[model samples]
Target: MTDRIRRLGMTAARFALSGALLWLLLSQTDASALMARAAAIDPRWLAAAFALTVVQVVLISWRWAVIMAGLDASIGTMRALRINLAAFFLGQALPTSIAGDAWRVLKIRSLGFGIGTGVRGVLIDRTTAMIGLVLVVLVTAPLLLARMPDPAMRWSVAAGLGLGAALLALALSADRLSGRWASGRLSGVAEFGRAVRGLLSRPVTAIPIVGVSVMVHLLAGATMWLIAGSLGLPVGLVDCLVLMPPIVLVAGMPLSIAGWGLREGAVVAVFALVGVPMDGALLMSVLLGLLLLLVSLPGGLVLAFPEPGPGQAAPRRIR
Candidate 1:
């Protein structure tokens, strides 16, 4: 009953967030006018968009595996791919916060490893992955800043660059703090600290993971470009690449249900800045959301196969 209620709450939250975004988008839009504009798209492009999304899924899996491997969680590439696919599918079908993370955590648990290590490994992996994302925005921000055209986008770029710097500092610092605080023979808090410190001590270890993560985002941006192309919109891959990183940062925020309202609003704004029509951007956002949801359906099956264990302790994914 508690679990059911929790799921229901998450669903309701997601529905509300999605609903609010639709409302905001529609509030400024004339449905008839937008539909008329949308009629210009070729139906074949939509199919192409689906193909691009499949590519994105593949890339995401690879990136996830790479990050996990950095933490010494040695799941084979194929298994890691399955795990990432399962996590993504679960994230889309179920509540964004609960499902995707649960799938990852549980899959990691199934690997016949310590739950604590699996959890920490996933955490570290995500941190490394996100660090890579930040690096992308930082590295590319200057390259794209001069071409942003709009003052707001330029400002957005600046802000993103600053944030990326801050995150890098934190990741670099996390290891030192962990060493200082975790350098005891303790098993609880100290153990965690030691583990964190150990991971952080090898900054070189994280670099490759960060590089792969940036590549993953690039692939994802290409997927978005493909989607926009499918809709017959004139969106360049560079535009998608530049606009994608910041929007992802927004989507990761927990303020909205799985980041629905914010995702559309951010994408629409960025798209418009890049000279894509507002309505077209809006349409593409909706389409992308649908595509992701559809792709994640198999996560339902993955979710069903969660490892058996104690009350709430999930299984490991690597041996």
Candidate 2:
């Protein structure tokens, strides 16, 4: 199918899932009750969530900047930030990985990174993000088992975690392999060598980029916790940090279109083990996702007529 058709189909599906989620929230949940609860939420906590949200966005962009700077390239922090927002918007809104990752590559291209360099760097950026996800789960899994372990669930969590670590290791190993292949076989090996060399030769930048990437993910868990508060669930801050990311990692699987009802369902399931209602958890997922989209929509404006950046050249589209 064409990209236009896929997007339209995804839009229709997202609308349908969104409607279903809203219906569940209204029909099963006491909207008035939740709203009253939300309204009565501690102002200090809400203020902190807002502050944390801004900090999360800025720090995530900075993590990307760490990678870009390692490559000896500098994109305006504002541009990097907006582009990061755009990527997040796509990552959430689109059904499949291809479309969303494509959008990321394009946005970087529009900012003036040559296609190859943009894609190469984006790959690393995403890999680091994956690493960050693993770090979140690693820290949180033990806590969950200590408090709420089911034999089957514990086993499942362990396997899933092992898989995550393996994936991250694969990503790091892939970089070495790609670097070598870029040198030995390809026509543009020289550029690959240069980009790889530029990216790897700088340990000074690597330390901070990886560190900030881990923090960026930790902040994401905090955002999930705050959103939980928005629904009056009162899950522990540490629990929220551990619980949400793994479910989100599943939601991000390419199987679902736009994550749709699947993400909410998973959130509801995970929290239900701790006795939070499925409907209320779904409500929290819906609201958190909505806020994310609200923050990320500015990307559409940036994308409408994008300006090229200081990077190498725009990447060529795979299709």
Writing each residue's lDDT as its tens digit, candidate 1 over 55-133 gives 7677656656655665677776677767776777656555566566666777787676667666776666566667667
Error of 2 at 43 (Å): 6.3
Candidate 2 per-residue C-alpha lDDT over 209-264 given as tens digits, one digit per residue, 9 for 90 to 100: 66777787777678778777765676877777777777778677655556656677
* Alpha-carbon TM-score of each model against the true structure: 0.78, 0.75
lDDT on C-alpha atoms for all candidate structures: 0.70, 0.68
Model 1, clash count? Answer: 10
In candidate 2, stretches whose alpha carbon ends up further than 4 angstroms from where it belongs are 1-44, 90-100, 110-112, 175-202, 304-319
RMSD of each: 5.8, 6.6
Q: How many backbone clashes does candidate 2 have?
A: 13
In lDDT terms, how accurate is model 2?
0.68
